[model samples]
Target: MTTTVTTRTVRYPADGLTMVGHLALPAGTGRRPAVLIGPEGPGLSDAVRERADALAELGYVALAFDINGGRWIADPQEMLARALPLLDDPERMRAIGHAALDVLLAEPRTDPDRIAAVGYGTGGAIGLELGREGYPLRAIGTVNGLVTGRPGEAANIACPVWAGVGSEDPIMPAERRDAFAAEMQAAGVDWRLTVYGGAQHAFHHPTADHEVLPGVAHHPRQAARAWQDVLALLAECLPLGEQAGRAS
Candidate 1:
């Protein structure tokens, strides 16, 4: 693993809009495992970019892809106004994820076959959509992403899926969490779900610069734990220097 990491801004077209993404690369030889990062409802922010860089430091090429084109809306209501419809449409989310995947794969440093998707909030839903669309991901990890996929479509998920959410998150209440777990279970997918006690929605984004809505607050401790869980998943499913077999 390389300690030095490099990052860059990439622009690509998706869903009739020009999306901007942050790509992070680790310093070393050969192609390396890659991760696609999806930002929360506020769109791509510095927090997401830093995560990509952190992944790069761990020797994985990471791309923090943008939503809402290149804009970042800090107003909670406005953000929801823009994100709600898109969240309801799984195909659109899948298209966005695929576009970002294309960008990640085009990079010379990325190992196309050893790839994973991790997302937060709306971005997490996008990652799940990618899994449901049969993207051959090594694993899928979501934080506070309570959205569920089409009925029976989870059967296409070829990789292990992991999710983290706050126990008190009203947006991702017990009912929704149960439904998501049921979907994965009924599809016979390898999956796990962790509920962070005493935390609220979006607990993983303490670095967010916006005024979050009610029921959404950052819990630094749980956020760190969730991140460690994500790292553990990658280590298990997409370990570096090993050409681990994955669904083709």
Candidate 2:
């Protein structure tokens, strides 16, 4: 059976500012599992929206959320100015996440309890914060976003986490990776990490349209493989079929 996915723009308030997000719904009727997606520091773009569309095609309600009032940051410095601080404050990130999540949960097509969260770059850290704040997510996936958080908090995360990063990523080097692993291990959460060799930060992105920086480029092969890893994680933790019922 072929299904047609639908896409719509959603606007909601977060941190006293309006956030614009994209929601994608699968064809046919029942309630479906959802994935709350966050984009990199440069803000939401077609890349993340396409991810939502892809998930919807796979029968999952997906939302590609924004952090900067529906705007995409075209400058690296500006993005860093806004994102770097939020990364340090888990509470603020959770607030932004909660608002985006509310948009996803409000949709009649979504199964509120069967949702997962995934983020790329700074967005990835925000999704992890949602899990850390006990959002009841079924799974969490991060690509180049394994940034650490306040200590003793990974224990709050209840679902499995999957993180993928470039082995050559200076932003997230060996020491940081080791620390993240230690944190997850101490919290006893089911976690996994895959470091793609010869790739740099944000390697999943196909181009440098929004911002350009050294050590930040795309790797076609690694990007494709990382996407496959994401799919596998979602499949194992938030499987589709049988549970696809219309929202009540």
Candidate 3:
């Protein structure tokens, strides 16, 4: 642990909604590559904020962008009520993500040229839409985002993408996964997917307090392992430390 990670709350506008995002800064940093994080369908939580802090420990500026109007949803139905409609609207999704990106960009310590995005569930979908809208991300990643987007629009993605899902995730069946993979291939996207056996939806959450459906549960082992994979994705794409070397 860096032991000196600092965080701040930011409020911004997106899609006519006032959004709140959390920013985590690394210890002893010059300008560094930035990461934008999207939360699960229920919205931002300690889980997502902790992920941002972890990224800070890795020496990157990280923002856990808020959807769900800056509040956590405890009811599964409520989560779907808000998330589904946004998921259906690509432009709206991109708008929300772009607002968060702006927040990341405004920071003096963030290197705008080297940025990536990672999201869970609905947030993951938003991150993909950000790429599909040509956000200049170095990489995009999602975990169980229920992948499938507007037809023929994926060609706009300009960065590598990584996605993970549970093998038993009913919300993301094999066919949908296949479709997402096919879309990426057709678009010439560098993409990869990892399916963790016996895990269910939201397995990376690390706690059951957020679980409102039997279909979703957290797997600690898988969560730790998946974080490693996400870290590797960032290292390969943004390389926070290497950006300074390259700049010099």
Candidate 4:
């Protein structure tokens, strides 16, 4: 099937700053299920746009969000400097993400009831925050995302969660992963954690540099698997169609 994908630059407020987002919409006649794609560190990149394209090809409207106020940081220290504060400010991140959600839901061709979110790196953290705040998403997926923030954050998530990580990731260790899994279980959330063998942080990035982030490498096989898993989760949890009682 042929699909059309369009990109638009939109702005939202986050932590008192204006954040820009690149939204990708699937072209068709009726409303389509939507997904919020959170950005990886270094803000919006070509890799993110490709991901948006991939999602749109799968028949979902995806918005690749801009964090860090649309600024790019080439140095690892600079990136960390900007990311650290946002990671600690979960509430603010949630507000920003929710604002983006509002934009997506307001789209004329988007199905608000069947919304979901997927994030990478800091973006994943934002997705987790949104899930914890009880957003009405059918599912949430975090790819190699950090597991810091708060312990009570996962308790309020009402939908299914899929968390993918690298087995050799030092940033998010095995203990932390176990703790996160335990918290999700205690919160009664349907959750799955997949650790890809020999994969490290940011394994999905096609342009990832192992020198910048040691032990963090990208594997095409793992990335493809993760993408397929996300698609399956979305299909199972957020199918596109009208309900019997809904007015047409």
Q: Could you give candidate 4's per-residue lDDT for residues 143-168 as a string of tens digits?
A: 87856547676778889999999888
Over 4 Å off in model 4, which ranges? 146-149, 241-248
Q: After superposition, how far is residue 46 of candidate 1 from its true place, in Å?
A: 0.9
Residue-level lDDT of model 3, residues 59-171, one tens digit each, is: 88999999967789888888889888988888889889888988999998898899899999988999999888887999999999957777777899999999999897778
| Clashes (N, CA, C under 3 Å) per candidate | 0, 4, 0, 0
The RMSD of every model to the true structure, in order and in angstroms, is: 2.9, 1.8, 1.9, 2.2
- The digit string of per-residue lDDT tens for model 1 on 199-218 reads 99988887542256888888
Ordered from best to worst TM-score, the candidate numbers read 2, 1, 3, 4
Q: Where does candidate 4 have its weakest 10-residue lDDT segment? A: 239-248
**Model 1: what TM-score?**
0.95
The predicted structure with the larger TM-score, 2 or 3, is 2
Indicate whether candidate 2 or candidate 3 has the larger lDDT.
2
Best by TM-score: 2
Models ranked on lDDT: 1, 2, 3, 4
Q: Candidate 3, which ten residues in sequence have the lowest lDDT sum?
A: 239-248
Query: Where is the poorest 10-residue window by lDDT in model 2?
Result: 239-248
TM-scores for all predictions: 0.95, 0.96, 0.94, 0.92
Better of 1 and 2 by lDDT: 1
How well does candidate 4 score on lDDT at residue 140?
A: 90
lDDT of 4: 0.80
Tell me the spans in candidate 1 whose CA falls farther than 4 Å from its real position: 208-211, 243-248
